[model samples]
Target: MKLLHVHSLPLKDVIIDLAALFKVDYTRNCGEYSVKIPSTWGTGSIKGINFQGGLGLLIYDCNFNTDVEIHFTVNDIHPLKFLYCLQGKISHHFENHTDEHPLSNYQNIIVASKGNDGHVLKFHKNEQTEIYSLEINRKLFKSKMACELGKAKPNLQEIFNDDLGDKSFYYNGLYSLNLAEIFEEMKNTNFDHLIGKIFSESQSFRMLTQQLIQFDDDSNEDADRIILRKAEVSAILEAVEIFKAELDMLGSISSIANRVGLSGNKFQNGFKTLYGKTANEYIQFLKLSLAKDLLVNTHDSIQEIKYKIGFNSHSYFSQLFKKMYGVNPSIYRQNYLENKKMNRSQKDYK
Candidate 1:
């Protein structure tokens, strides 16, 4: 796999190209900005002015002069998008509905979607603000980078809003450095060669994978005793399916245990014993596995996939998917398509 070089253009050009790709009209200017972005491709847009630049990442200075409203209406899919506010405030609206979230200085918003419809974001401006934007295909992160990053199978939405916010030494400044290196490689190499290096040599991604495995190991100890109980295993599995089927209902381990006529601790232990995983882990696995199936077989949006897998929040779904799979779901889907194409081509040649 090769890392492809994405040519940077002026903000207007970027917006125009994105609009063309989405086949929608987006209005913006040197002043008061507005845009109607329809979901298309791996579409992403940033409404802000440019700031200091380094090697890999580009920082910007932006103020939300008016409310920034983004309307996303494609059913059953979530788009992968990231936004960082280095200096100002913003809010988010989901399903074309509004939610008030106060974001102060040095705050950021990262959104990863399995799929959703009629979602919107409105960023209100109070004072002069500076924002930094990094937009890449979610597939890039999934294929060559995410596995090395020690990310857990994250809920997609959570990965964008939470995981991305939890910056470490490797993902912060070092991430910029890595991006620079990747870009250099892209400039000097073909897509295949670049992707190969990215997949193989991304230290950030490798570290993430290591951390996730370790977390799983630590969690496994608590799960061991529970795994030994056959009855508990049966109950927990039943609970998981029930939760899956009844999206409106949820239960704790104790609740599940009570339903099975067992103590909470006993049920928990039995669940671990039978499943070789905790109840939470089992649920996450079930969701992620289901998400994988949807991404592979259906052209559903990321938001739709998130909901289908019983994740009420797209952000949470993205986070869980990343924590488990190390890459966002959108990226995984793209890779699936690319691999499928490659496989088909190989068969034809054969």
Candidate 2:
């Protein structure tokens, strides 16, 4: 494992410097940042935007060739961070903490501190993790609230006041499915330029508000415990990745369970509990989503796509596709083409 220590740098500079140290191609434009790490390190790109008024938004979706640990030491104020992991695992251990905080899929953590604060984060090898993080400067956030709403509202006051007004605090919990869908939609959108930036910035704040509501809610304390062991959870998530990769072969649940060293019943129940859907349903959802993408983006015929994705009957595939997307495959393809052409014409006219 490779370890790096960063001392007292702004987050943007930290990322840029890290990219160079890791030998990755990095880009920044109009406040948005992107880093394309090589396959030897992790074959994916991390991209997001950082805005003024003390807000920083980032998304990390990658699988690394080796586990890496990065430790941060802040010489100034500690920023409040809301970090949600969607697909893999990342561990954070802040100063004065004995044990690491493991954030897996669907889990979130909030961190703030008054004194100089720092944390150590570890990314696992060969596991593709998708994480979205929002960081806010505490004083700037409060000032922004006062300027926009005329005062620091009660809830805002409470957040900044919690832990005896100490800025350094930690809250860990799970986020709702609605929040996950919003991120998914944002990731799937094709818009770019000023329009994309504005939309992303707006949605980032919207997500922040929603996250803060959940962060302060008292009901989250009673959330159910995850029944599966940590090893089981890791195994199941790996199985999910395999399921998506080999959809054409249609791997059976029993096979997946066997591979993961879990019994079939435990596998099914545990998977549903972790992912909020049955294994079959999730796989079908993936299939339909891929089918839609092929329909819109590829020249493959509906029948060909159906056959390619392991569906024998065109009618059966069409029925499921319509149920999921509210349109049959052919119509969906037609509308996608029309929209593309119209967009082109509008851009040309402009």
Candidate 3:
């Protein structure tokens, strides 16, 4: 979508217009607000409190302001987001993603898929905040970056590290400055030239993403060689898929080791090196994910669900579920159902 001209309108009007264009539903009550938007054009739902404004970056008058909390419910499978915080703070809660380090005020946080959820940020208000958001399309970015790097799959982590370098700062603040500078420059430049600059930078970013992916792949290969005598990243990945398919049978480390033709110690260490988790840990993760799905989509009783997922005891399942999700399974299910009801009621109001 072409960036909408938002120079002179009231903030609320601008927000509403943008929401409409994006097919998002929003309500502003007091200083607190709420927004429900599709994570992508066609699918996924992101619901959150727009305490000041919803989660995303905004740039106005060279300053940055982002104060919104977005709970990514569906279709947000990737880890990177480019947001412009317009007026308030924003906290992002991740599902299974973690940051390598805390983001500096002007750096970006690389989202790791294996990381935990609940990653968040709070952007303070700034009158001069005039921000724009760009949610990087990972597949597209990866493809384009790979072309630039001359690799089929590149390491995005290293690419971002190299590009941002010591200048790394929190993702929001860094992008705030970059975007503001670009937008300001755009205002003074010819339209064609402005578009050209954006496209060039975008292409550069794509290349950077690819490089990082390649770096990560190489890192894995190196680590794998140290533990497995011979590195077979592809085979390990295949084994992981197989293990996922028969998660219930993965109770023993020996079974996993035998499948990969390695001794128990080698398999354990190699799996951790390649995938960042032990065999049992990975199995538990699969089980947790399955439990989450069941909690959300089915009416199965907790005990029944636990037994089905190979958890013999209800209390143990509940504890593990809470540890991972921050809420018990029953509560999680209840909350989801309540939200669904609330959404329906809101729709009826409209």
Q: What are the Cα lDDT values of the candidates? A: 0.47, 0.75, 0.47
Candidate 1 similarity to native, TM-score: 0.32
**Compared with the true structure, what per-residue lDDT tens digits does model 1 show for residues 1-350?**
11111123433444544355446776654321223433322223334222111001223333434445444444333333334444555454445334544444534343443334333444554344444444333333444445543464453323333322232111111111123333344335543444543532343243233323333333444433222222234556667677577543456657766775556665665566556788778777777888898899998999888777668888888888989888999899999999999999999999
Candidate 3 Cα lDDT to native: 0.47
lDDT of 2 by residue, 1-350 (tens): 97867664456776776687678767887767788877668777776566766787878888888998877776776567788888989998776665788999788887765467577778999988888878776666666665654454565565554422355567777775446767888889867789888888887888887776555453323223223433457778888888888888876888877887767765786788788999999989989989988898789988889977879988999999999999999999999999999999999999
How many clashes show up per model? 69, 5, 44
Query: Over 4 Å off in model 1, which ranges?
Result: 1-237, 240-249
Q: Candidate 3's residue-wise lDDT over 46-67, tens digit each?
A: 2211111112222222322323
RMSD of each: 26.1, 14.0, 22.1
Highest lDDT: give the candidate number. 2
Residue 63's lDDT within candidate 2 is: 86
